[model samples]
Target: MDPLDSSISLGAASEAAAAKEDVESPDALLPWARFSAWLECVCVVTFDLELGQAIELVYPLDAKLTEKEKTSICYLAFPDSYSGCLGDTQFSFRLRHSVGRGNRGTWYEDGDLYNRDAPVPLQKEQSHLYGYVYFRQVKDGSVKRGYFQKSLVLVSRLPFPQLFRALLQVVAPEYFEKQEPCLEAVCNEIDQWPAPAPGQVLTLPVMGVVIQVRIPSSDDKPGDSPVTPSPKENLLPAPIILPSPHEQDLFQCFQSMLIHVQMLWELMLLGEPIVVMAPSPTMCSETVLALVSSISPLKYCCDFRPYFTIHDSEFKEYTTRTQAPPNVILGVTNPFFIKTFQFWPHIIRLGDVKMAGDLPKQVKVKKLAKLKSLDTKPGIYTAYKTFLHKDKMLIKRLLKGIQKKRPCEVQSALLRRHLLELTQSFIIPLERYLASLMPLQRSISPWKTPPQIRPFSQEEFISTLEHAGPQLTSVLKGDWLGLYRRFFRSHNFDGWYRLRLREMTHKVESLHLEVTCDADLLAWTIEKSEVEIVDLILKLREKLLRARKQQLGVGEQLLERLERSIHTVINSLPNDLQALLHRH
Candidate 1:
């Protein structure tokens, strides 16, 4: 079998088994029952004078990791900083490992092995785990270095940075005071917390802090909630609440480049390769995270590294100019990346956050030479032309808010909501067109093969855009249809189509099963001739075989019942006819 086919077969089998289990035990569908725990492992990384950064401790002791994995974690935990600044810093990075391996050389929590082959359908299977690190540097007289610097890293598949940071804030300090036992207590606490289920408001208590967050779902609407709630409402002794997992302030990070917000959104939606250069890891990582979340409800399908370094395994692959840059967003703090990623199409250089009353520098689109000459100045260097014209009204409103001395958080919320609505408007048309492609229930026939979804035609989809395309706002003026035409050629569109196709196929299969289960087998067999009854039996048997071969989640109990019904019908017939049928 082809490798891709093999993978699909395996995935279908897994889904089928899971569906069967879910049917057997309804509780299996619950969020808490599906996942193991929020926290995977607690890693303590310290800077050594001779060996550079090294892993001082990994809680649970037996948490499996390769040598290269350990090195990568240590480097990522500690920022690429030369100065001995004493404070706390929080950032995140992707922890990648091969898929085929058991739990032997990879990070595993609660004896559960990483079963997911890959997030995207790639040739090589790898697991991408998110690692949230909280680093602290404090003056210490005991150590000869005078400063005790270490990072307490939380490794998990969950991408809730704010929640993880809060947990670290409470746990890291206590860990420094009391070593191994503190991590043990924290792990126990995390294991007790409920799973991070999307579309639900979860109240998670870790150590002393209680975190309340709502994981965004694809089904969320733009107008569901206000951009920002009143301060009075938030002061009711509430836990650290975030509306979404990607809670980084967009207005604050891109304050200088607010005018080009529409252009940035376009780049993200198209899956363009962009690089973000910032002064600190915290800023770089947060900005990257914010960019990826710009089109909320629609997940960014491309690979993104929030905090990438020279030591990362993919360093050579990313930096090499032998081939075109892969569709990815890389965040880096090092000055060296400016020269290395010069060939990349889009680059956003950011300055340090300024104090109130300080004039915010406006972003200028500059050439590579100008960017190199004025290294300190923030700017966007890109040659990519945006499809849609700039939304000047949105920019004017944001600028007006700034002029009126509105809070930064409020301004950020405004931008976030605008982006969300913009994405929804763009997606709504495509969704409508795809919905039209699904085979209708009335078209299905019992004796016929299952109907396949209509093939997606670019021209057919585009024809409806004039009437159905984005109409949420009238602020922007340009060829909206043209923008969509270009979008159809993008990786984002491909990923979205594949996902929708799978979902539609599953729905069709479920409908087929429902129809089969509701069939009046005994009555139909009674009316039919012996040869016709035999043919019907053969058809049913063929469907069962096909379902098993396809690895569909067709319930075993349903199959058994269908089999019993066929036998009952056969036995109800004349004995000679039954014998003839059995012989055939």
Candidate 2:
């Protein structure tokens, strides 16, 4: 199986005819008879490009090939009443020889010669030789003696230079159209843009590409240059000043974005995330459609995961099948996305800055603000309370709605799952909050007591027991406890709960009798009523005792201290232990 023989189509009846034509038409770009036979099988082919999008092409039998067969020319024609840009277009493309014995060679369209590797400049309502051609040999030689995979790239000639220039201006206005700009030049221009300081967002609207740019550090230079501090190092980056496109180009500027897909490809490769913002779903869709079809040399492109944050009506159609890869994204901007993701990408201004319009105004920076959870046990508790506080109204409403509903098993199950989801969502914050509190617990001074409290350890112990008791009981009784266990191992919960309870209990029993401060004792007594404190302790001890009975791995020392705390709190309560327990 010689690899060369497989693709060369040796010893075929049509080879002699093709070889003859090659001799006769040394410069007559005509398709080989053998290649023509292969083109007949090409129904249609489509490809999804990185920034631009999918290219749709149809190969007609009248296509022509160069004498070497490595390059070919074709009338890039779509069917009558065909879907995309309508016109008879000419494409000149290059073909790749096959690789392995079984491997088919691949080729993509070439960028516009006049446009200089920019988008293929197609003319509107007129026929023109624009776009590229591609073909591959197929192995199934049984039925159709020759079969080749074929594709075409055709775009409307809508004067894309205007939009390309606009994109350049939005990205770096001062250097707009100064000359053919490269990445390094653009970065330098960006370094001097009258844009907000780093971390602040700057919006740029070209045509299809809407950018929400975030300035990282004013001093952070993009290209390789020896670091030079600004004369006023203390000053922030200049405020964003959006450039107005020339009025003549402004009208067609939106459509011109279809021509500059190269800019996006370059931006993505820049190693920083590119945030593409759009004005509306309609605009986003139209822009993306124009982009995918207009990109030059549309073959041999990389895969892109396009994520659409469109309206509910369009979500099913535009949304990706899976989560977006960290690299790619295309959608509208909103606070939800801004707050949800920890990192922000550098912006790509599409048409003009004003295109973002009121969309940016809708972003409530203060309302969407979030602070990382504090580190400390109390901090954890505080965070837990914060999470609950934020959602308390919703939880109450859900519970109330559940109460009003007829007790159907399915409905009840759904309500239960809803509660579980709500609870699970905030558990991370709680865990983080608790983890932060550990150091504070360790840092408490053993020799000194706070002015208005019992021993620090004892107060913390009582607080832990009170908080842990209800949670443990809820877990034991809730039908959805399995959901909690699935994410948090049972041993983890038990160990965390046990440690806090044990520490608190140890401090309480080891209290010094050095005339305990009356004011501090009185304040402590008011903060935690004897009866309520006793009840909570008893409940925790009961849960621990049950765990011990079931061999759920309760530590012996932890259990003993819990029991002692229960007895001591019970003795201090208003009524005797039996009466207090029964009433509670």
Worst-scoring 10-residue span by lDDT in model 2 = 376-385
lDDT of 1 by residue, 331-389 (tens): 89888887888889889998775534644556878766655643557888887777778
Cα error of candidate 1 at position 461, Å: 1.7
- TM-score of candidate 2 versus the correct structure, residues matched by position: 0.19
Return the TM-score for each candidate structure. 0.80, 0.19
Candidate 1's displacement at residue 326, Å, is 1.5
lDDT of 2 by residue, 277-353 (tens): 34332233333333322222121122221223322222343334355424333433332433233233333223222
Pairs clashing in candidate 1? none
Give the candidate number with the greatest TM-score: 1
- How many Å off is the CA of 252 in candidate 2? 25
Best by lDDT: 1
